[model samples]
Target: MIGEREVLTRAQLMAGGLSRRGLVRALNEGVIVRARRDQYVSAAAPSAVVQAVRIGGRVTCLSLLQLLGVFVFANDVVHVHIPRGASRLRSPESVAKPLGARGRRRARLHWWPLSATPPAHSACTGIVDALAHAVRCQPPRQAIATLDSALNKGLIGFADVEDLFALLPRKYRVLRSLIDGRAQAGTETLMRLMVRGLGHEAVPQVHFARFGFVDLVVDGWLVVECDSRAFHSDWAQQVKDRARDLELAKLGYVTLRFTAAQILHQPDDVLAALRGMLGAGRRKPPPRN
Candidate 1:
């Protein structure tokens, strides 16, 4: 049963036939880890991750996003949600901000708690609660990217998204429309929002002429590609990308590629290029209602 959270209390270890001598041996060999205050977790598990739950807080927000392989910018803070009025959290080093508010910059503490966190899942916020915290606290771009990644991974479904919005504060509900599974990366969502914010419709991961999906298509003709340096650093991928662009060009789609840095850091240049192309095509952006 190593799959079920992989943590154990000392009592659990004793009940499972681990003798005191065996416990001592495992601890000495570094095969078992002390998750603090009478709790024991596998050596492979991060101490803080186990301690977060052991200290009676559920991990949430950017911390959970990083754990779930979603697109979050940083994890300087260990985000943990404690039920209102509980003060069991104890890590001083990472909890950089002065304690009080929930959305503090580092080692965030979400004070809201909805239901009993089942003992089986106590170490982390339940998926829904974590998503709610993410939506309520993050900027729209960050929120949508995490949502899109979760949707793409089938970690959450359409109904779940609706439920997440219903659980969020009124201010965050407006971002529901921007949550799209077709966005493959945070950069894609950021670029799409930039284009749409300027009144242009940009569809993400659009497939053309059976040539697999491109990163985005704008105004039904301009293909905008964002190459993340982390994934597209080699000659082979570059060659394949160019080949795809040429194939799309044959089908009347003009492809414009940008690096992830350009998409995130150089938004002005990206917008300028997009506006120039839109003007050249004589395409008027559709009116938004």
Candidate 2:
């Protein structure tokens, strides 16, 4: 039978009650496509997953996270996990051609042993293995954000995160303290890190009466919202955002809104602006009793 990612070996199909003739008929009907010598993928499998299997690897790291709707920062290439001793691998685009040096740049390859066995017919690695690889693949803050995204989405639990850290080298263990599952988005995690880097407490998803959850509150006064096109693109959403800002302003909260692009791409500039804003002598209002 086809696995979660819709990849199956010919033997698996045969064992799953498909007669030889049925298998042939299914292939002829385009129900499945031959991925390699012995591997077959369902027609519905994602192209990236199919390509990863074609490249002689499992889909993993940022690539798999993106497919699962987890936040990944600037993932421009497919991340493939090749076994430590893999050889004669093919390019993702071709089954017969070798994965030469040029093909290497087209995909990010993690040459390592899997932490655990994945589903027999799955084209992707298990979540823990993928997270371990993801941590190594990303920078420290972004790695935390990636882990936070996974935890926030309930893809993995705190114990799984601890296991992921155990799989990593010793230095990465320190990042465990920084993982916050409450982060609603990667941009929020990034901004929170920036604020924390400035020695400020960045409380996430703070709620005020009549104003839903704000993305972050710095020092109990400054509100930071990470605006993504998915939720804040239309004029209607913008108007609602403005109204929220105005309502919070009435309660003595100053809101700073940053686009996903600015937070992800212009991080240094964002940090500088945040530092200046926080340092400009703005007074905090009295705490509500």
Candidate 3:
């Protein structure tokens, strides 16, 4: 086995039952490729992982989170984790050449010391370390969303949250209370934060007897739905959403739907609209028939 990320050192491969001859045979047959003198990766390894290893570090931070299927705000470049005090970094294209020699830098390197040693054949930093670095890499609100996403996806548990906080500076501890694993999407997380910033209590994923769970409920009557294109682009989904809104309206709940773009890129405008709506007055739901 090459490893979960499909990368392993020659020694690791040997220990996993690949004899020296088998290793050579694998290399010759293109089953594996040498990323470095002793570092070997399966031919099917993720390019980002291979690239990070070639660049003399492990994939980490937002880049690593993205690879792990976590909700990362952005991943424009590879984020490599090089040990503190490391030197003589090599280019990802050709390890012989020094880093930055080929052309523009291809990766964002983090020189922070790792809190714990990664697995022997890991092509990426541990999830906790990646998350610790990720929170610092993103803005405060985005950081909280990232944490919420990780928790919601079951990638990390509540106990791991404390470990992640321990790795961060003291000031970041304040964000601990803001994380809510019930948020199913990054946009929902952002929207919840916006509502809270306006002094409104926002409950996420509230289920009703007749209807399924809504994204958020603010002040008990205002329903906030974060519609990402991935789930809402189809006409059928749109029809269902409209029907749900109509049903909620009958129950005296006002639904405000926001697209992912509006929630992420136009926060001020979205917040302003929400502020206006919340200021109007709360709509009390009618009594049961």
Q: What lDDT, from 0 to 1, does candidate 3 have?
A: 0.86
The collision pairs in model 2 are: none
Please write out the lDDT profile of model 1 over residues 5-90, one tens digit for every residue.
45567788888899999998889997876655566667776544654655456667777777778876445777777777876455
Model 1 Cα RMSD, Å?
4.6
lDDT of model 2, residue 206: 83
Query: Pick by lDDT: which candidate is best?
Result: 2
Over the full model, what C-alpha lDDT does candidate 1 score relative to the true structure? Answer: 0.73
Q: How many clashing pairs per prediction, in order?
A: 1, 0, 0
Give the worst 10-residue stretch by lDDT in candidate 2. 280-289
TM values, all candidates: 0.86, 0.94, 0.92
From the highest lDDT down, the ranking of the candidates is: 2, 3, 1
RMSD of each: 4.6, 1.7, 2.2
Q: Which structure among the candidates has the greatest TM-score?
A: 2
lDDT of 2: 0.88
Residue pairs with colliding backbones in model 3 are none
Q: Return whichever of 2 and 3 wins on lDDT.
A: 2
What's the C-alpha lDDT at position 208 in model 3? 77
lDDT of 2 by residue, 1-289 (tens): 4644867777788888999999898889988878777889887788778889888889999899999988888787789999888887888878888888777888999987888988777799999999999999989999999999999999999999888988889999899999999999999999999999998889998877686799998988898999999999999999999999988887888989999999999989999999998998757653521
Q: Name model 3 segments beyond 4 Å from true.
A: 4-6, 19-25, 101-104, 285-289
